[model samples]
Target chain A: MTSGDESRPVTEEELHAHADGLLPDGRRAAVEQYLAAHPEEAARVEGWMRITASLHDTFDEVLDEPVPARLSGLRPPSRLWPRLAAAAALLLAGLAGWWLRGALPGGDAYREAMLPHRAAVAHAVYSPEVRHPVEVGSDQEAHLVAWLSKRLGTTLRVPRLGPLGYDLLGGRLLPGDRGPVAQFMYADPAGKRLTLYVARAESGETGTAFRFSQEGAVGVFYWVDRSMGYALSAELPRAELLRVADAVYAQIEKVPG
Target chain B: MSDRDRIVELIPRLRRYARALSGGRGEADDLVQDTLARAFDKLHLWRPERDLRVWLFSVMHNLHVDQGRARRARPEVPMGGEALLAPASGGPGDVLERQRLIRALEWLPAPQKQVLLLVALEQLSYDEVARALGIPVGTVMSRLSRARATLRALLAGDGRAPTLEVVR
Candidate 1:
């Protein structure tokens, strides 16, 4: 083994490179020697290798799953005519949507109507997480509120839920159709979790009345309060979820001006 | 094969990366669709001299960032629990251990997760991950180390607080 640097102890970074098999030929032998002299370090390095091995075993199968058709559906760039046609169709859809807005029941209500659907979707997306239910845990409630407020361009608050037996789990920032969204998660002692998705309401979108929607086992309570749209979604029965929603609304509505 | 055919062949790898990135199959499909569509639309903008795979991944990464900015959040979907837990051949202990690993992975911060996935999962070189993420190679190295350490701590039950098991 070529030992160019026999006197120097191997660094942690070099050991990591050794574990990942990225070490140069000269350094590889030195690292092997270092590990040989240290059985405990060898065990730790073995664990890292196991982590990578397990990760590969677990997810490498995904590479074999057939690519979904929709992802590969678009015609190649050589098909200029079809691409132009598709672009034109998208334009027409935009025009049609704009024209239908006036004909539809109050335009703002239609937007409001979609918020609960989004809430339900987001709930379906996040509620079953075995871990990582929130971006900022309750320990950083103050920081979460401040960060989300800056992102959404509105002062945000985390509603207290102690009385309802649900404690703040944390909150995560999400992409909304228009702008940023803030979703706060809470869970009861039994591990049943609920989420509150909040986003800035579009200008002229106004409503205080709570609307409800149910999807599968999930129920959503959504409403617009001036410039904010709030959706509370959980797997509880309608009445029980509504009670929690009412409490959430009351706590948030009292956010100091 | 033509460049278009080359891209088609790369779809499965892209899908795999998207699956790991998004954490949910449906959301992964959406990301792939959006990425492929955007790549096709912007095909002319691609320089032929560039590595097409890296360019495509950069496109996907940028698109993901755009989507995140517009929506202001990473994907919120939980992986389907039943599918993961039902590994058929693995023992219950192995299944739980795998589940714990998945959970720990999900808890990683996005930047570290991105670097770790690119380097470890996709087997990309540090330079390639840096180019794809538009970060320095040094940053990639640091993030990879931190991610591995964090996952180690989490799996060893040292980093996270222990919770009482809820009895049904």
Candidate 2:
């Protein structure tokens, strides 16, 4: 609502704000002048004011009414549930100590194992989309790559998959455990989409070995290369996905490494 | 601090709000008890980053909506329990008008009544009302305007909903 110029009349929004005492003094004065010139609108505004005043008068006393004992005595009974759950977990761990040791992946092994599953989950969430498949489209691939590289603090590249019968569909930035992850999407001739999720390696460690993991229908091929960890996730069978993963690996490895 | 203590502090204000919404002290106390129980059970869903008051109001509003739906399904259930009794110390005329005001408030659509009460009674800012109701600021402005208009018309007794018989 305009309150700047005399020519810019006060609008309905301004009037409502004034009625509610939400407008600044300057704007409130402008609205008052407008209402003065308009008697019917002024009358309506006065009615609204009266309504608020009456409402306040009618119910303000409830605030001072002695709160019922039932309400004051109410407390969440589940406050200790978290502590109990934690205790149970510790007990289970202690009971199965010998069997669990070396059986469960922890530390670096846990990170290496979970990375692909995260990529697969991201794929499951974004794939099969009719619209908004990527935050930035492939037409602005150069800008997308530069923006992501800047955010992740790394020189990132979008690998071309033209020979693999999939076209680059651009990328989006996503939250990762350690830092930001840059995910690039590609669509095949059949319209099936795959994603390449890249993020900084934990502790700057590098692992060139390509490992596979799957969740539901999605399969992921992830590896840590130099300062970055990369995961290529798709819903295709393992054999078909392996071929695409190899191509992606080769293309990414050749980026001035 | 635990959610229990945080919620306990808000009980007075919550009771006040329930009193206004339910239109009777007994019903309002019942509503408040239900709301507190629901809030406690759903405490895990609350995020520390969000405003606790607004979240509690949202839970209470949802519970009220569910109760309204169930009430509507059973129209045979008699409505209007004990009339919202304002003390007669304000004089007979003032008492009747106050009773009329409370009755008019109950007759207003739940959405408008909510916006009006949050702003007029609770003095919540437009943004806070929007967050509590999960509506946009623009909607808040419009709904509030409509609510106040309906309230004014009803109080003026311009022939809308049936007038509740004021008990002596």
Question: Evaluated with TM-score, which candidate comes out highest?
Answer: 1
Q: Per-residue lDDT of B25-57 in model 1, one digit per residue for the tens?
A: 898778777777778778788888877888888
- The fnat of each candidate, in order, is 0.51, 0.64
User: In model 1, which regions exceed 4 Å deviation?
Assistant: A1-9, A75-257, B69-93, B158-168
Mind giving the per-residue lDDT tens digits that candidate 2 earns over A1-257?
A: 44355446777767777777787666666677788889999988887777677666777777777776456645543234543443355334433542454445455555565577667766766654434679999999889989999999989988889998999988899998887888899998767789999988878677669888755567788898987888998879998889998998888889896
lDDT of 1 by residue, A1-257 (tens): 44346546788777777777777776777788889999988877787776777677667778888766555544363245543444355444434554566535346545655677666666766666543678888999889999999999888888889899999999999888879899999999877889999988767776568888765467889888867999999989889899999999998888766
RMSD vs true structure, all candidates: 17.2, 20.5
- What fraction of the native alpha-carbon contacts across the interface, defined at 8 angstroms, is recovered by model 1? 0.51
Worst 10 residues of 1 chain A by lDDT: A77-86
Residue pairs with clashing backbones, model 1? A125-B77, A173-B73, A174-B71, A174-B72, A174-B73, A175-B71, A175-B72, A175-B73, A176-B71
The lowest-lDDT stretch of 10 consecutive residues in candidate 1 chain B is B159-168
B1-168, model 2: which lDDT tens digit per residue? 767788888887887777787777887788888888888888889998878998888888888888883133211212432233222345323767677677667666667778888887777778888988889999998888777766665555443433332210
The window of 10 residues in a row where model 2 chain A has the poorest summed lDDT is A77-86
- The lDDT per prediction is 0.74, 0.73
